[model samples]
Target chain A: MERRSKITPILLLAPAILIFVFIFVAPFIYLIFQSFWHYETSYVSKQVFTLENYIKLFSDPYYWRIYWRTFRLSVISTLITMILAYPISRMISRMPPGKKGLVTTLIALPMIGGGMIQAMGWMTMMMPYGAINGILLSLGIIKEKMTFLGTETGILIGLVQSFIPLMSLPLIASLGAIDPTLEDASKSLGASPLRTFFEIILPLSIPGAVSGMVLTFMANLTMYVTPSILGQGKIQVFGSFVYQQAISVGNWPFSSAFSLFFLLIMGVTAFLSSWITKSIQKSIYKGNEA
Target chain B: MKKFSMFLLLFVLLCVASTVIASPAEAADCNWDEATCEILDGADFGGRTMVVGVWGGTIEEIYRKYIIPEIEAHNGKVEMLLGGTSDRVAKVYAERENPTMDIAYTNMFESAKGIKEGVFEVPSADAVPAYADLYDVAKIDAYGMSFAALGIAYKPEAFEGEPDWPDLWKPEYKGKIAMSTFPGSDSEGFLTIAGYLAGGDDTTPDLAFPKLAELKPIPLFFANLDELFMMMDKGDVVAAAVFDSYTRTYIEQGANVKFSYPKTPGAIVTMDTLCIVNNAPNRDMAIAWAQMSLSPIVQEAFAREIYFGPTNSKLVLDEEAASKVIYGEEQANSLIRMSTYMTDHRDEIVERFNREIAED
Candidate 1:
């Protein structure tokens, strides 16, 4: 029976493990290996191991500019998404059960159409003669049309809009799990609403907030379509740059190296974020003990 | 159970009767010798299916309307994989060993790369009878189907007269002209034009970049033909470096656009080639399809319908149709062909373009 139980779990997990190995792990390993190869042309790559691809990336100031731009835009977009998501999620968490579901669905409606559809929607509204410009013109906000296409500002707006749901769902889950009586207890003890929120609610929601930020930041970091469509090939963010190298220029080795470096940056950022979250929670617990 | 079986019998009988009635009508209309038809009468394909990769939109529509029926008449099936040249080339490379496509339509540069990588079968007069009818330029790496001359396409209302390539540098047109992305055929043409204007030929290609940057036109970079047309129609851009074939289509569709082949050096020519995959599954059908595509009838139709300069030397168009395309030997000779230069310096050129012109 013990052997059967062990075998049963392994069997049940076999399909998932096989899928992960083939789809994710194998490709990831190949990508790393490919980064070490030398690119010859579009359809040709030599297998002789070399670090030329990485050297090329590090040597060029153009690549550095692109990487720094990608980082700055991702950070700004994630921060804005988190700031907007928190209050909305908190409001929904405190709502009546029926109303909570309705509000939650409304929060997630933009995401239901997927990223490409949302990007296209924004494209329709953000074009020079689009609805946004028309509205602004009617209201006499400006005499001339504003250039939204091929600008970093336009890409930032797209990133924040698309990633807001990713930030909100985790926050809503964590906030909803909090016991209402704890807030009531603090209130009954003469703590102000703002004070109770700072002392109790905020600290308890750190994990969810951290998770949301990490996911949104990671997503925005590798964003391709939104930036490419909104940026119109001028912005040249990290994701689109990789695409230009891999697909357009047919420099697979260079693209692979670029991707691996981007992976390292994302890993470090995620690690630092989690470490900071842990430190904050430790301090909050120590304060309570005191 | 009896009623269900009777209904099934009736449905099967109906389907058989419909096909039986449809086959003869289709077969009778098949003109075997016609260049536009897909199949010869009495030739049995044994139900073989040929997959063709071609550009979508009007091109694919024309093929479906005129070509597929004849193939179907001879018991052959055709499946179309519609996408850009790069998309199709990437697929062919990824599946090189056992390619999913039988025939792929690609630009000259990509076709050259494919030939170098041993991804395509070299065409010969024996394999494709229409090979005899192609010009020397069209017979290089693959069977060239059509060519387009690149020039300035502008709004008729925006300018008093036809603008030359140097007019792109004028201060008034800054931030108003759109160009295709670097590493694309259109941009490569623009680079060559810039090089010519700078008094540098293919040998001194580097001089073109500085000249291009001097224009300082913060142009919208179009990723596809559809986007270029959309921006032009919406008046988001006033002018662009575009192909004659595409601009002609837009003008016919009443986009208020006019294309001018610059008088000083004339337009640059880009060719689209059709090649069979190295290990294509349906080799015979693939060869036949390639031959049919280059047939005089099809070539003439393409020239008339889409303003594509037909690769078949025998194809003769009317004066009006010939005016829109690079038709004769004189026009062909005058047009700049940059296939060799582009193939050699494509990587450096794209990298520099991204760094300087596109980013700036």
Candidate 2:
């Protein structure tokens, strides 16, 4: 009977495995293969196997810096999203079920809306003589026009706005599942509001926070359109750099090498996040046993 | 119970397989091509469908009104794959081995780039009869079709003075200027403008960057002509480097924009060209469509209605439209032709421009 059940589960997973092979696994293998090869000048020339592309990528500062920049941007953006997400998620968790949908819709609107439209709207609002500057100028907050698009500040703002929802959704679900009695008990035990939040709510929500961070980091790392549109191609992210090498320079081997490097960085980040979350969970379980 | 679970698992797999098998057939329903044209006395197109890649908007409108209808009259079908110049070229390159689009219209530089990359197939004179009628400038198959220059398009109310390419870089006009967003193709015009502004030695990035860097205060860079015009409509920007046809169309749409040829020596010229994929699935239909599109009648119709000059010399324009375009023998001689030497240096120029000039 147990054997039959095991066979059924394997059968159930067959379609998923098939999909993974056809879409993700095959492409991943192809990308890894292409990374160690050299492309001739011709559009469809046979690829020559070599590790020169990776060697050059690693040796060059321009390509090397992008990996660090991508990592930094992803970490920074993820941190910002988490900081913003916690408060919003907390407020949503406290809300009555009836009003939750309205608030949820408002928060979810940006997520579901066209990214291109949001990007354009953000550019118009953030650019020099745009809404932000226009208001600041009128109010005498600044003497000179500020350039937003193509600046670091602009890219950060674009990344944050694009990713806030990703961080918040998981956080809301996790926060909502917390027992109300835990907070009330902490309050009764003479812990201050801030202390209660730190000792109770924050600790319980670690899993959700970790997941949100991983998601936001991945999204920001792979982000292409927002940064490209707002940064005016001046800001170089790994994704955009890979894209430029592939599309503009027509260097497929170099591009493939960059892509593999990007995937590796993203994989490391994801692994670290899960490891941290798991350790935290283990500690919490040990405390419960005590 | 295990038997039931096994059955359920099998059912799920069958469901997924069914969904996958059904999607493609459903997609083909809306975009059907008639095997035979009713307009051409029921002569069949031998089950051939010509996939055309071209620019959208006004060009798209003209194709529907004149070009496609004309082709359909001869029992041929044309499916217009609309996108920007670089995107169209990229698509052709991506599908090099198994080309989907039979005919594509792109800018001259991109066509040249594609030709060098072996993405486009060279056409014979027999395939394009209108080649003889094209002016000497357009006759060169650098990539695809003839070239057009980027001249000054301005609002007289906003500027109140005649402006040349150098005027675009004036510190006074900083934060008041707008340019197109895609720099890869438009960088040539910018370089030519930079060359003239820095005194005709644009080959050096040293001279070009300082002169072009003054325009760093430009408030906006638009992705398309429509966005640039929309900004102009709101009196945000005074002038820009744009083509003849776009300027004319904007004027027709009641945007108070003036089109002028800057008398600056070596003012920037751009080209628009058409190309066929090397191994097109429907070569006969593609060639026929190309001949039809570049034909005198079609080119004349494009000029009169859509505002771009036809490459064919046989298509004589109405006086007003003819006066607007930078054509004829004297006009052709005055303009500088872009050489292969300039194209090879395109990457370095773009990188430098982005690093030095574009940085805030």
Candidate 3:
């Protein structure tokens, strides 16, 4: 009976494991191997052992700037998404079940409509003569039309809009798990609303907020379409840079090296963030015990 | 005597039968006409699909009308893989060993590089007889499909008249000048012109970078014609370096833009070439497709539709159509092109462009 159960589980898991290894693990291994290969063109690579690709990446200050800028912008976008999602998540958590579901779906509209479609939408409304400027100019908010499409500001707007749902869903889930009476008990104990939020609600919601921020941050980190469309070729994010090298210039080895490097950084960032979040949670737990 | 007569008759009959059977096979691949290129009697493709990689828009439409249907009529199927030149180039190179794309259209520089790398098959007159019908400039180891001159596409309201390349530096149009992305014909042409303006030709092109930097804080680096035209219409972009074909196409669509062939150095010549991938699945079909593509039928179709200058020397357009496109050898010769140094340093130059021009 024990052997049959084990065999059954293995059979059930075999397809998924096989698929994951085939699609994800195999390609990842290939990517690592290719990064070390010599570049002949974008598509053609020689299986020679050389670190020329990494050497170029490390020596070039331009790549360093691009790396730093992508990290910085992703951090900024995550913080902004967290700030915007908290209030919306709290409000949705307090709503009736039917209303909550509808509101959540509405919040997810940007994600559902897809990244490309949303970026394009933002583009039409953010151009110099686009709707945003048209309305602002009509109201005499500014004498001249403001440029948004080609700036970091435009890309930020797009990133925040796209990632807000990612932040909100987790917050809503964690917020809904919080006991409503706990908030009332804190209020009854003569704690103010702000104090209740900081001492009780905020601390309790930290896990959800962290989850949301991590999701949003990762999304922002590897962003391609938003930056490509909004940046108007002025901005070079990691994704766009990889695409430009691999597809546009046909420098695959260098692009693969760049990608592998980004992946390593991403893994480190994920690990560091997880540790930091855990530390924050432990400190909050100690404070509550005291 | 009867036996001798019988043997003689049999010999004559056998000779006549053998001649009939061998004549058709010999005449099948003959490319007879040199004036107007027509599809030659070639092997039936057994209804197999020949994958073609080319640009989508009006270019695809012209191929569908003039080139694709002819292949279909010859028991072949043509599947179009539409995208930018770089995408096609990447695919052709990647799939060089066992290529799915039988034929691909690419820029002259890309085709040249591909030919050098042996990813694309070198064109020979024996393979594509229509090769002989193309102009001298079109025979760049691959079949030249179209010619478009790189020039300024400017809003009429911003300029008093046709603006020269140097005039783009007028302080008033500082942030108003849009540029195309680097590692492309348009950007390279603009860079070459900038180098020329700084008193250095393609051979001595050291001063180009600083000259391009003068137009920094660039408002836009347009990837497509629609985006550029939208900015131009909005008055956000006063002028931009663009291809005459794209500018003319947009202008006909009621866009408020005009193309100018800047003097002192004139317009830069940009040729689009059709390449057959090496070790392609359908070599015969790809060759036939090449014949149809380089023929005057498709050439005239492109000239009529999007004003793409015909590479086929035999193609003769009416006066009205002739005035719009790069018409004769005189006009074709007037357009300037940079040397292979641009292609040689393309990777490094692209990185430089990313750092200096594209990045803020």
Candidate 4:
């Protein structure tokens, strides 16, 4: 009976283990190996072992600048998404019974159809003298045409629009999970609506905010098609850089190294966010215990 | 009950296995060759199958109107393996060890790179009899194949007159001009154009840097032809460097785009060539297609419909089509043939461009 039980678990676990090894672990190991090798020019060119790729990456200011720019863009994009998502999420969470469905449908609308169509719509709307430009000009808000699609501002706009959904879902869940009586009690205790938000709601929603931030941040970091298309190759994000290295240069080894490097950065950010969220939770609960 | 389910599964498996085993044998049954075409007057492949990897879009119509009909006449089918240039190249490269294509088309630089990497075999000219009539320019055998040039394109409405290479550097056209991010010779051509105008000697791009830097804050740097076309269509850009085939099509489509040969010898020329994969699936079919592609009739058809200049000099086309094409020895000699220097200095020039020109 004991042996049969042990075998059952192994059988069930086999598929998961196989998938993990095949999809994630194998590629990662290959990436690490390739990073240390260079392409040899001989027939079936031998991969020469070298630390030069890493050394070159370390020495180049150009690559470092690209990395810094990518980090700044990711953080800025995530922050904007969070700021926009927070209120909408709270409002939706507070929506009376049946209206919840409508709010969700509205939020989920962008995700329902293909991304390409959504991207195309944004392209037409965001171009110089495009719909946004025309409307702004007619409203006498701006005189000169705004260069949106090719600029960092345009990239931010696209990133924020695409990632609002990722942020909103978690925030909505966290906000929904909050007991409304806490807010009610704060307001009842002579606190203003704003004060209640700061005192009760904001502190309670730390977990979701952290989750949303991490999700949006990672999405922004690994972003590819949208930025490449909208930026018109003007903007060089990390994902696009990896793509160029792998395909254009056929430097698979360098691309692999770069991908691992990006993954590490993303992992650190995720860990930091999680740690901060946990610390905030501990402190808030500790005060409750007192 | 368990046994019944297991038997049912086995039965289904057997059916799938049989189909998989049989499909390829069926596909290969149809003979694709010149002999088949000749004996049948080249009309026998109507119901047979032939697959080619191509850059899709409006360019697909070239196949739809011309190549398909010819293939269909011979009882043949042509499947399009479509994507961007990089995507298609990666796919073909991955399948280099065991190619899935009978014929493949890619840009000239890509084809050259592929040849150097041993992703493709040097084409057999004997198989392709029409290869004899190709322009001397096409004969430049870096990648073991011929290439077509993408002469300069401009907005006729925007320019008061036909502006040559130097006119791009003129104060009037400053900031109004757009150029694609040319990784190699294309950039060299632009730099050279500015250099020659500035009266600098030596093919080194150092002399051209200052003049190019003068056109500060180049509003856009397009990644692809489609993006460039979109910019031109909206009048966001005026005169820009582009391929003749692409510009010609746009002009025909009622766009305000016009193309001209920049008078300063050779302004810039891009070559799009043909190649056979290193490990093609149907070797017999591939060699046959390469030969067939070089036919004067096919070359003329490629020119008239696709607007790509035929390598075959004897291939006559309509006057309008012929006028746009730059073929022949005199034109070839006049043009500055791109070299390894252009490729090697790419990073430095682009870096300078980004720092000096883009920052503004």
TM per prediction: 0.90, 0.82, 0.89, 0.83
List runs of model 3 lying over 4 Å from the truth. Answer: A40-46, A179-181, A184-192, B1-47, B69-76, B203-205
Question: How do the residues A1-290 of candidate 1 rate in per-residue lDDT, one tens digit apiece?
Answer: 99999899999999999999999999999999999999887746899999999999999988889999999999999999999999988999999999998988898899888888988888778878878888999999989988787888889888999998899999999999999999999999999999999898998887889889999999999999999888887889998888877777777888999999989988998899889889989999889779
* Backbone N/Cα/C clashes per model: 0, 9, 2, 11
TM-score-sorted candidate list, best first: 1, 3, 4, 2
Off by over 4 Å in 2: A1-15, A39-46, A50-52, A280-290, B1-43, B46-49, B69-79, B142-147, B154-161, B166-179, B195-221, B225-240, B251-258, B342-349
User: lDDT tens digits, residues A129-220, model 2?
Assistant: 57998899999999987878777678888889888888988888889889999999999999999988877898888888877888888888
Best by TM-score: 1
Model 3 error, position B284 (Å): 2.8
Q: What's the i-RMS of each model?
A: 2.0, 3.7, 1.9, 5.0
All candidates in order of lDDT, best leading: 3, 1, 2, 4
- What lDDT tens digits, residue by residue, belong to model 4 across residues B87-188? 666677766677777666766556666677778676545555445556666655422222345356776777777777767767876777776764433445
Superior by lDDT: candidate 1 or candidate 4: 1
> lDDT (0-100) at residue A201 of candidate 3?
91
Residue pairs with clashing backbones, model 3: A42-A250, A42-A251
Per-model DockQ against the true two-chain complex: 0.48, 0.14, 0.48, 0.21
lDDT of each: 0.84, 0.71, 0.86, 0.68
The TM-score obtained by chain A of candidate 2 when compared with the true chain A? 0.92
